[model samples]
Target chain A: MTPGRKLLGHIALLVPPFGWLGIFYLGSLSVLLLSAFWQVDAMSGEIVRDWTWENFRILFSDTTYTVIARRTTGIALLVTVTDIILAWPLAWVIARKVGPRLKLTLLVLVALPLWSSMLARIYAWRLILGHDGVLNWGLRLVGLPDQNVAFTNIALWIVFSYLWLPFMLMPMVAALERIPASLLDAAGDQGATPWQVFRTVVFPLAIPGMAAGSVFTFAVTQGDYVAPMLVGGAGSEFIGNVVYSNVGVSGNVPFAAAFSLVLLAMVAAYMLLARRFGAFDAQ
Target chain B: MGPNVLMWNTKDITTAPTSWSIIYDKAYAGVITVPDNPIQIADAALYLSHTKPELGITDPYELTQPQMDAVVTLLKEQRALVKKYWALASDEVDLFKSGDAHVGAAWPYQANTLRAAGVPVQDIIPSEGATGWADSWMISTHAQHPNCAYLWINHVMTPKVQAQQALSFGETPANTKACAEMDALQPGSCKQYHADASPAYFSSIKFWKTPVRQCGNGQNTCLDYSAWQRAWQQVKQ
Candidate 1:
């Protein structure tokens, strides 16, 4: 093909996807950003389209929004920490300890939950965590007192950790598997203790993987309104819940858009902090 | 106006709960579930309309700032009792089925689904009345077949069809004549739903709608839906 023709072909290939993103993704985001500065007419329940900072004023001035943001961030962080704790050992076992045949099986098992519907999994957790659910029933059978953890922050924490565990596990497993066995042997020859080797070599090397996984756990938990609604109890309102209610139930698009911008700012700041910690350094 | 209702586990209480106050009762703390919507403020307003008449809350959807504050305060107290605010009908069904929630605001559909699953549950339009939604089928102006759409609407509005939908959905049939059809389809179903009840029974229900500043009583001092939404977030927090 001629050079000019090749250049035209490359441009043609890029145009569709770039145009689509420009129109749909960036276009909608710009619209949302624009709407955030607009005001809603109280009497008519319509967007007035006049530029104003009233929405931001309400969001920043209100303690309710502050409390919600704090709660959402706290939950997201908790879920991420929990997933890391749960995934690290499991991922390590699959990567180093387990046989090749078992490693594939275990990896598949980690990913199995993703295949099913999220709502279905959440509902299953609801049943297992309820007052008279299997968890309590088993406790009673063991002669312990029944526990009611359903519809609380504890349940939200459990469900979020469960839902996002695979995201953390897969990345950690990949990172751990990529570490050369010779490196570990070298450490052993130098009389390095197991814990010391892990702390100095394994842990720091896995930070990038954990950070990659956290991108999923943190973002999903921060923005998830469904899990909280299905499993969360009173006082479990997340930032997503507030945005959802405003957009869906109240039809207050402007305010919802404004609230989302606050959430976007927070997530962006969190990502930057994560980057500072070398979470994405490997990439 | 909507299919939403107050549902409770019949096995938990000897007698059926007949008042909205059951949800606020301290005994049911951490076991009650209400809706997680801004429109739910109407339920609190409905309760206040009967209990606090001096507030002059003529319409639950139209509440003055003071009246709204009173409702929000009451809801804040009730928030401690709520296990969760359900956003979906099936979630409430699961709540009752698993015995997670003993009582709270629910949809008639959830109650029916639970009972069908052999869960001992009952729903009521409590003594203080309740809030609901009136659903209507609409066709877009860009419809490809308006004639077919009209035919579909007419078919659905027929007594038999209305009865089938109303019974299945656990909602009131718009067609008054559907009462007999409902009884014929499922004996006592019409009575169970108050399908042929007096106008007072219908009037007791405050239909769900967007709350604007212009109160239904011609007052302009009422809080809008956004205020309720923000207040609800605060209450839950």
Candidate 2:
């Protein structure tokens, strides 16, 4: 086919997806951005056009800014680190040692939890992490402190880590699988320890995949409201809670909008930094 | 001559406006706005208890653990079809405007907005009647639009407007004549809304003094708010 016709084919294929993205995601975000500048009448619930920087001022000055930012950033970093540690071994096992059929089966097992609703999974975690929940009940049988043991920050971190594990594992497995067996044999032949071989050969190759996984874990957990609401205590209240209460409790949509924009900026800066550091190298 | 009307303990109903009250009219389901501030609950409870006890609600003064449990159970059962458990008066206004709620336990100002939005909303004073807060329509010390604002106040308080507002907004009109006019609209149904200016309605609906374990009085030890919070959490769990 001529280059022109080929371009036409590609354009036709891209149109529907492009239209969907433009109308829904981009359009909604534009409106949300507008809402950030608008002020809400305290009594009337009316959106007044008194364009003021008061909303942004609150975002910086209020206690909500510190509490929400600290919790969101803390949880995001923790989930990212935990995912990396847990994913590396599982990815190595799946990519190198397993039979093709067994590998596929194990992959299915890892990915299966993703099929469940995010809300249902959170509720299930709550059951396991409640004060009188399954974990405490199990611990009580073993003669542990049954009260105030579960339902802490530790419980929330565990749930968040569990939720995002597959995101980390899948990418690492894909990256590791792409590495030829000859590369490992070459390292082994040079009298390098398994640790050294891993450091030089495996680690560098997997950095890009690890970075992608980090983005998912960091972004999602940073913005997650429901997990903290369902599982975490007062200390676990994140930016999501601030955003929610601003809109619902205080009826201060402009401040909430400003807060969300700041969050978006933070995530954007993180991604930009990751890219600058060569986090992605598409093969 | 119209029966005398006395306003009692409640939040600044002016904050909510009067247009968001239709939710209560549809379901006849008892409503509860939560994080359960005792005074707010008490006002609604006392109002309901005296004027419309057939709803099987207890007085705020008499509210105890068992009563709370019953209320919770009732709320849970009606969760599927409640106008809503309104957190903000704005939310209540949205519910009224969208017709999601027919009779709401809402702020008066919210009900006013809904009426402006053409929803035929009313804050009904139930036969066992309504409870709302003290929000005087006064000229602010820093008044900008003084005459217009005063006109706005007088217009709202006018007898015909008050009657229409009582029927439409679901609140007890301050004007006794308006309340009477509302009573005449559906005769027997209006009695509960008058509430007899009961002492229970007035004194009982004070700001919820969260019980402190070591209250200054040294007579009786009150359970702390933390205990109540823990208990509430356990119940949810």
Candidate 3:
């Protein structure tokens, strides 16, 4: 083939993906940003062709929204930390300690929950966490007091950790696997304790993986409305729930867009910070 | 939609609560659940209309900024007592059945479902009255088959079909004639669903409608649905 013809064919292959990124990804993002600055007609609840900072002003000035932002951020941070801690040991066992067959089985078990619909899994948690749920039933069977945590922030915390644990685990396993076994043996030869070796050698190296996994765990929790709506109650309203009510019930697209931008900015800031910490080094 | 019933566990308390104030009581903290909808704001307003007459909220859906502020304050207090805000009727049903929610604002359907599951609960229309919706069939403005749309509307409006819908969906039929047909389908179903309700009974319920700037009081200054929605988010927050 001629050099020019070959080069043209290469560019042709790049078009579809670039088109998707540009049109679907960046394009929608641009629309969202622009709509945030648009105005809403109070009477008919229509988006007017006018530019205003009213939506953002309400978002910032409102104390209730400030509380919401804190709640969403607080939960997201809690979930990220919980997932990292939970995933660390399991990732270690599967990556280093297990036989090949067992590793495969363990990995499958970690991913099995993801195959089921998230909605179904969350609902199952209700069956387990509700007042007369499995947990309470088991407690009663053991002659323990019945506990109620079904529709509170505690439920949100438990469900979020369960849902995002796998996301944390995969990256964690990848990071742990990348660690050379020689380092551990060398540490032992130098008379370093196992705790010392893990703390110094294993933990620092796993940072990148934990960081990578946290981007998913943290960001998804920050933007999640479904779990909160389904499992969350009075004090458990998230930023996404407000955004949804604005768009779905009120038909206030501009306001919803504005609130979404706040979420985007928060998640974007976290990702950028994670990137700065070299979370993507493994990738 | 049926009236937003105030339901409580029969075993938890022997006496049925008469006021909406019980949902806001601190005694029920972390066990109260209500619908997680923008329309829930109206319920809060309806509660205030009786208690705080100075706010002058004649229609639960219609409110001035000051009235909204009062309602918001009341709801924010109630927020702390809530265990969760449920979206689906089944969620509320499960909550009550599981004994997670001892007292909550729910619909008749949940009360029925819970009772069917052998959970002892009683639902009452609080002294402040209640809010509800009368779902209707509407033809799309831009329907490609306008003739078919009108035919469908007419078909559903007929007494026999209306009775069928009333029985199946558990909503009162608009056609008064359908009430008799409903009884024919299932004896006492008409009275059970309140399809043959007295005018006074009908007036007690504040059926839901999209709040507009131009309200029933003929004032252009009333806060619209968007405002209620925006305020609802803050109240929940």
Candidate 4:
């Protein structure tokens, strides 16, 4: 095709999506940003159209910024690390070593939960992790005693890690499978042990996938409300809970908008820092 | 503008053209929006005035003590029949619109829309009473149109103006004097939009108060939402 025709075709493909994005996402964000600057008469539900930094001032004061920032970062980091650790072996086994049929079966197993509704999957975790749930039931069958372990921070992390495991494994497996078997064989032939071959070749080749997976897990889990809401009990109050409560129950839209903007900025900064450190470089 | 006046409508369920037993029996099983808003309480009080039922409620003013007790009993009995407890106006609207609920409490806007769409949604004001919220028009300290705002408030609060609004919004008129003028607007509209609608029932109806902690200045200071949430969870359990 001619360049002009090709360009026209591309434009035709892009225009509808661009139009929708402009009107819905971009326009709405712009309005939300504007709302952050305006004052509200809470009782009257009236909007006073004046530019002010009072909302941002509230965002910065009273330890709000410090608390959410620290919480989001810590939760994101924890989810990313834990998901990767759990996914590494599963991905490695399914990538190059397993037979094609078994590999596909295992892949189906990994992908199964992705087809379920996010809310249903999270609630399923609740059933599995509740005080009198299957996990306790199983423990009791095995002569283990029961306790109030489900309503804790650890349970939240486990459920979050489970929820994001597929994201990590799918990427890592694709990255690992792309490496030729000959390369690993060569490393082993050069007197490198099995562990050394993996360290020198397999791990190095999967860095990009690791980076992408980590980003996906961290970004998603940091803002996820369902898992925390279902499993975290009172202690599961993350940035998502704060944002939701501020907007809905509190009816403080401007403050919620400001906090959301701050969260976006922090996530962007963290991703930039990760990329700058060559976290995505596949050796 | 003076505080935007929130408006609502309710049916006269107490002395509807039908029998009280049939209505209540049908309502409990039929699907109705339980009043979750302040205005709904007032609207319900008004509806109760006209009807004399053999069962629990006949007076609206006695609603809080009696109503809460009734709800606890009803819930214990018919908890399974209630699909869900809706917390927002849109949720109740969805129930009616989607046919998840047939007879229930609803906001005026939703009812109007449903009626326009040819849905037979009777705005029930229980014979016991009609319950509703009463909002005042208060200008902000920083209002730009302080004079206009006050003008708007007084103008809307007048008998004729209040009746006109009551007819349109389906709310009980705030001005008691507005009752006479509303008769010209519609046959039953005035009675439906009475400020003290279903007075016999409403005289006993209790108003919804914001939850408060055991403190002197009860401006949402006492019981923080977190505490309320914990209580809600315990109540649910």
Candidate 5:
């Protein structure tokens, strides 16, 4: 085909996806951002389309929003870090030490939880973590004191970590598998210790993968409100919870939109930082 | 419609809690729950309206600035005692069934579900009163089958159907004549839910409504629904 025809073919290929993104994703996002500047009529509970910054002003001035935003970010960071620590060893074992057949099994095992309903899994956690729940029952059998971690930040942490662990594991496993066995063999032959080989070779190469995983773990935890609603205790309000309540319960769409923009800004800033740290470098 | 009632584990409490104040008691700290909504602020106001008469809180939904401030302060104090604020009836049921919460605010559905699941639980409208919802069926103007909608409404409004719904859902029927029908359907179920009990019983319940700044007493100084939402968020935090 001629170069002009090839260019036309390429444009045709891009049209469907670009059109979709433009109409749905970008279009809806723009509408959301625009609504954030509108105000809600307090009496009638109607969205007044006039431009105003009252929603943003309230968010900035009220210390409650700040505290909620901080708490949410803190939980997201903690979940991401916990997933990394938990997934690294498992991913490494599957990618390196395990046989191909077992590696596939291990990968499936990591992903098994995702197949079930999220609400069902969170409810299962509720049963496991409750005061007289399975965890406490096991503790009694083992002669250990019950932790009583249900409905606390600790419970939220456990659920969030569990929910996002697979996202972290998959990328790390892929990165680890890409490392040639000859490189490790050479490192071992050059008098490098096991710890040194890991620290110098495996760890550096896995940074990009870890960063990629962190993006998912961080973003998902940051925006999730359902887990918090079902499992979170008092004072465990996330930014998502605040935004959801505003929209669903309060019927204050403008404020909800504004609150969402705040969350979007936070996620965007985190993505920029992650990108700066070479998260997308492999791509 | 069912109201929010105080529910406690029957096995844990020898004497059922008789007042809403039991929720605020320090003894139940870390084992009590309430609804995770701004509407719950009215419950706090309802308690204060009876206990702290000086606040002059006649209507829970139409609270002036001072009354609202008092309610907010009371809720912040109650916050420490709350184990979790449940958003769903199922959440409350699971909490009670799993013994995560010993006592808290709940709906009749939660109590009924827990009882059916073999969890020993009881619910009551406390001495200070309770908050509840009243639902009505409305047909849209643009509805394709307006006649059918009206027929359905008329059918449900009949004493027999009303009693059936009231007994099944554990709520008082709007049709007072349904009391006899409810008794026939299920012995003592009408009295059990206080159906056709007394005018005072109905008056005691502060029906749930959106809080607006315009007070019933013609005062515009009351806090609106957004304020309640913000205050509830602050209280939870």
Candidate 6:
């Protein structure tokens, strides 16, 4: 085969994927971003093509979006931190300590829930957290009082953490598995304790993986409205919920589009910060 | 259609509430739930229309800036009493069944469903009356089958069909004769839902309408739906 033929083969493979991304992903996004600058007829509920900054003005001046945005970002940050603490040990055990067969079993266990619909899983959490739910049933059996945490921000946090744990675990497992066994052996030969070897060597190598996992946990939670809808209480409204009501309930496409741009900017800013921590390199 | 109502767990609440004021009472704080909807602002406005006549709020759907301010103030205070703002009728059902909410602003559909599930819930139109909605059917100007549309509307309004429709949706029919059909379908349903409601009973319900800047009194003083939507956001906050 000639070098030019090889280059032609590469182009053939690249064109299809590039075309898909260009037309579907970037195309729709551009349309959404364009709608942000438009306005709607309040009475008729029709889209007015004339460009205006009124939507953005209301978004900024209203203070409601600011509060919702902060609530969403804060919750996303907490969910990320919770997943990191939860997934780190499990990922390390699967990658370093377990046999290959057990490793596969553990990985399957971590990922088993993802095969089911996300909606189903969130609804299942409701059954567990409801007033007469499994949690209270267990408490009663153990001679303890029933507790009410259902439909609260605390319930939203638990559900978000559970939903994104697999995303965090899978990436950290890959990063941990990639660490060479020779590095550990070398550190031991130098008379380093097991704890010291782990602290200095294993931890540093895993930072990129943690950053990669945090990207999924944080960004996904930031844009999620379903969990908040199913479990969140009064005053637990997310930015996504506000955007949703604008689109689905209020039929204010322009305002929904404008608010979505805020979400995009937030996620894009997060990506840049994650990139600085080497999230891209791990992936 | 039935009015928006106050549904309470008869077991938990012991005493039946006679007014919308129970929702704002600090005594029931953390045991109440309401719709997570902007339209709920109308429920507040309806409450104030009678209690604070000085605000001059005649229609829940039509409001000036100051009327909205008063309604939102009431909503903000009621927020403290709410355990959660339910997004769906099913959500309220689950809340009542699990003892998460003792009383809430709900629809008749929720009460019927909860009672069927043995939740011991009852609903009512409080002393200030309640907000409701009417469904209208319109024929398209350029429709290919306009005659078929008319036939469909006529069939839907028939006494027997209206009774069936009312039974299915837990709502009342506008046709006066449908009350007799309701009794034929189920002996006590006509009385149960007040299908044969008097003129005075009908007058109390403030049906929903599009909130426009143009007021009924030939003024542009009333705020639009967009303003209501924004005010609702602030109320929840």
Residue A201 lDDT in model 2? 92
Model 1 per-residue lDDT tens digits across residues A1-283: 9999999999999999999999999999999999999987766778898989999998899898898899999989999999999998899999999899999898888889889999999989987999889899999998999788998899999999999999999888888888889988999899999998999889988888898889889987998898887788888888898888788777789989999998898888879977876667653
Give the least accurate 10-residue stretch of model 4 chain A, judged by summed lDDT: A228-237
Decreasing lDDT order of the candidates: 6, 5, 3, 1, 2, 4
- CA deviation > 4 Å runs, candidate 6: A1-12, B140-142
Q: After superposition, how far is residue B160 of candidate 4 from its true place, in Å?
A: 35
Off by over 4 Å in 1: A1-13, A180-186, B1-5, B137-152, B207-210
Give the winner by lDDT: 6
Which pairs clash in the backbone of model 1?
A: B1-B133, B2-B132, B2-B133
- After superposition, the stretches of candidate 2 with alpha carbons farther than 4 Å from their true spots are A1-12, A147-149, A277-280, B1-202, B207-237
List model 5 lDDT by residue over A1-283, tens digit each.
9999999999999999999999999999999999999988877788899999999999999898898999999999999999999998899899889888998888888889999999999989988999988999999999999887999999999999999999999888878888888989999999999999999998988888899899999998999998898889988999888888888888888889999999999999999988986788764
Model 5 residue A57 lDDT score: 99
Q: Is candidate 2 or candidate 4 better by TM-score?
A: 2
Q: Write the per-residue lDDT of candidate 1 for residues B1-237, one digit (tens) a residue.
A: 344577888888768888988888898888898987778888888888988899998888888888888988999999989888888888788788788888988878888899899999888777777787899999999999999999999999999999999988888888889999999999998878778888888777777887787776676888876687777777877
Cα misplacement distance, residue A34 of candidate 5 (Å): 0.5
Candidate 4 residues lying further than 4 Å off, grouped into runs, are A1-9, A274-283, B1-237
lDDT agreement with native, every candidate: 0.86, 0.61, 0.87, 0.61, 0.89, 0.90
Error of 3 at B220 (Å): 4.2
lDDT of 4 by residue, B1-237 (tens): 011111122232333333222323544442433432222232333334344243344333233344433433433333233333345555555455444455554445556666666655655433343334555678899998899998898899898998887777666677888888788766666655445455564553344444333333333334332333322322222
Question: Candidate 5 lDDT, tens digit per residue, B1-237?
Answer: 666899999898879889999888999888888988888999998999989999999888998878888998999899888999888887788788788889998878778778889999988999888899999998998999999999999999999999999877888889989999999999998887777778887777778987777889887898888888888888887
Q: Between candidates 1 and 2, name the one with more favorable TM-score.
A: 1
Candidate 3 global TM-score: 0.95
Q: Which scores higher on DockQ, 2 or 6?
A: 6
